[model samples]
Target: MSDPILRLEGIHTDIAQYHILHGVDLEVPRGAVTMLLGRNGVGKTTTLRTVIGHWQARAGRILFDGAEITGAKTPDRARMGIGYVPEDMGIFSDLTVEENMTLAAATGPLDPARRDRIFEAFPPLRTFWRSPAGTLSGGQKQMLTIARAMAEERRLYLIDEPTKGLAPAIVSTMAGALRDLKRQGASILLVEQNFAVAKALGDYAAVMDDGRIVWAGEMQELATDAGLQERLMGLSMEAQ
Candidate 1:
């Protein structure tokens, strides 16, 4: 791969006593989407968290753009133009939809043009503009989290399972929004379970098993070869 926006070399991460990631070497090409595919509980989320500095890596080098961010604090990582959309859909339930977006603005008031763009990408956020975040459905909440991350211009985004349990229509909407983000030149490292969606959006793909990257190549190659898909992703993974 060319010079990537984000790179992890020999990453090892432990959550308390349980070891999760073992030597996770990966790269997210600039201005493109890289799908991290794996079965349930195979350290996909752990990898994204490690990149965002949510969980400190036991050992490894994490480079964002060109600088080492292996030891940077989570807040510092956020400040340095990295946006994270976790699996949990981090949001303030008590806050209104508008409030949540305003908070994500961070530096100052939300920009008018950016807010409009977010609303265009996710119309539900506009519908529930003044409603508390808790009032929205699961898909809407997912949209909100993604919208929050898109509220500002970031160099890269770390998104985990944006379509986990969403309706097909909502999933389509989410996919379109992600495509727009790619068009806008934001590098995204996405952990997605829906292989169809992954194939549609990804330029490159990495398959993880037992905390290590087992397969990596262009998404087109993985999409076209069923044998490779079965060999790398397996029936166990697709069943999930």
Candidate 2:
């Protein structure tokens, strides 16, 4: 990992009575995708939320680009060039696709050239420009959420399960978009269950269990070693 762009040290977070993250320590390498892998209810989503300030950490620190941001508000974090694509696909359902895209461009209207390029990648967005976001299919809604984040250039993106609950074709499309995002030199902390996507996009991999990171290393190392995979995630990537 060449100088992590984001670091979480001893991060503890709780949602009411349920303690979700129990001291997560993880690092996202600069200009690379760091895959966050774990089973259900293991705090993968919570860790990403903590970094983005959606669910504040009860203890420990979160540093983004070398500045401690544990106490920063979500809007402030967003203004500081941190983008988040939530698991639920956070987009205004009532807003038109064009309207949703326009609102997320914090620096006023989006640049025309970049917008054109985004449209090229996700052509449905262009086709449904005037349609309400609520009318989009599940895959199209996912695309809208990712496109909303890409409406402007950000230093880092915290994406949670971008390929969840989609057909194989749509999953492949999502993977390609993420690959393109990586090609553009963007740092991504991705929480993915699909091992194939994780192995394909990740440069570094971190595995979490019981709200803490149990393993951290190169994705290739984890992908190839079935024993290590079983110990950390309780299943082989080959089987999944």
Candidate 3:
């Protein structure tokens, strides 16, 4: 396989007085989606934050595109081609959808080709082009968040719990959008709870528990092995 686009080695993090991530090691290969799966409070979000510098790593190295980025600021990481979509769907509530997209295109004005691609991936973005982001439904806002990340060319995407609280139809839409991204050769490190969505988009999978990775392998392997899934994640395909 080609070298990973992103790698985390012995990553440690703390939030307030509590240690969140402990010696977390992960690899996201180029041109594929790597699902970060775990029960809540296992430090999946913290791992993403540490990658983008939202939470500083207390120890260890973060290499992106073959260079160490452990000390890089969040904006520097963004400039280094890492796009992030936090779980909250970080859209500007008071701004128009167009404006939100424009802001996400940090390099310059929104490129027409990029805009076309984003709109094609999430059709609601076009329909609500001029509407305030707050006016959009939960699914539309989620689309906007992912679209904003796609506003510019990015080598890697760090997405957290994108399917949380969405209707099944919306989850299906989100799944399609991720598939579109994967087809375009975008590498993604996705933190997700919905096993069905994970099964659909993940090319590889990692299971975290108590802030450490306990299992790493092909997504299909985990999907088919009910005993493995039950042991690592406490859920089988039927439960999911």
Candidate 4:
């Protein structure tokens, strides 16, 4: 396998006197979806924030494509190819779909190509291209968030709770969109509690508990290993 596109070694994050992430270690391989699975408040979102430079890590190393990005500014990291889609979805309420996409467009000749690709992944975005962002449903908003991230050039992407509050059908649509991005070679670090969605989309899975990754392996292994699921994720057959 190739070297990881994103790697964190002993990453520790502190948010205003609160130690949220404690020596977290994980890797997002190039062109693959790496899912971070955990119950709520286990530092899953913090890890992504720290990676995107929203929350600074007081200790540890973050290397992206072999370059240390631990201290790089968020914009610098984005320019260097790391796109982040937060849980909030970051949609401008008043902005139209087309405006939102245009605002996030990467700096280069790839703008048109990116737009076309986003349209391909999200046909709904194209159909609602003239609609206000706030008028869209939860799923469409999530799609817009992802499409915005794809506007920038990136080797790795950090997405948080993308399927948080949507209908089952919309959740399936979101999953399909993620798969399309993966097919286009986007390395993704996903923070998701939706096990079914994660199982369907992830290539690798890491289970986090109390700010530390307790287990990491292939998604298939995680899917079949009921023992690990129960012990680490607190998931059971009944839950499934």
Candidate 1 per-residue lDDT, tens place, 5-123, comes to: 99999999999999999999998899999999988989999999999998999898999999999999998999899999999998999999999999999989999999999989999
Q: Is candidate 3 or candidate 4 better by lDDT?
A: 3
So what's the TM-score on candidate 4? 0.95
lDDT of 2 at 69: 99
lDDT for every model? 0.93, 0.92, 0.92, 0.87
Best by lDDT: 1
RMSD of each: 1.4, 1.0, 1.0, 1.6
TM for candidate 2 is 0.97
TM for every model, in the order presented, reads 0.97, 0.97, 0.98, 0.95
Error of 4 at 112 (Å): 2.7
| Cα TM-score of candidate 1 | 0.97
- Model 3 spans > 4 angstroms off: none
Off by over 4 Å in 1: 236-240
Give per-residue CA lDDT, model 3, range 1-240, as digits (tens): 469999899999999999999899998999999999989999999999999999999999999999999999999999999999999888999999999999999889999998998888888889999999999999899999999999988889999999999999989888998888888888999998888889988999999999999999899999989999999988786477
lDDT of 2 by residue, 1-240 (tens): 557999999999999999988889998999999999999899998898888898999999999999999999999999988999998998999999999999989889988988997887788999999999999999999999999999999889999999988988988888888888889999999999999889988999999999999999999999999999988888887787
Error of 2 at 114 (Å): 1.6
For candidate 4, the lDDT comes to 0.87
Q: For every model in order, what is the number of clashing pairs?
A: 0, 0, 0, 0
User: Candidate 3, overall lDDT?
Assistant: 0.92
Error of 3 at 81 (Å): 0.5
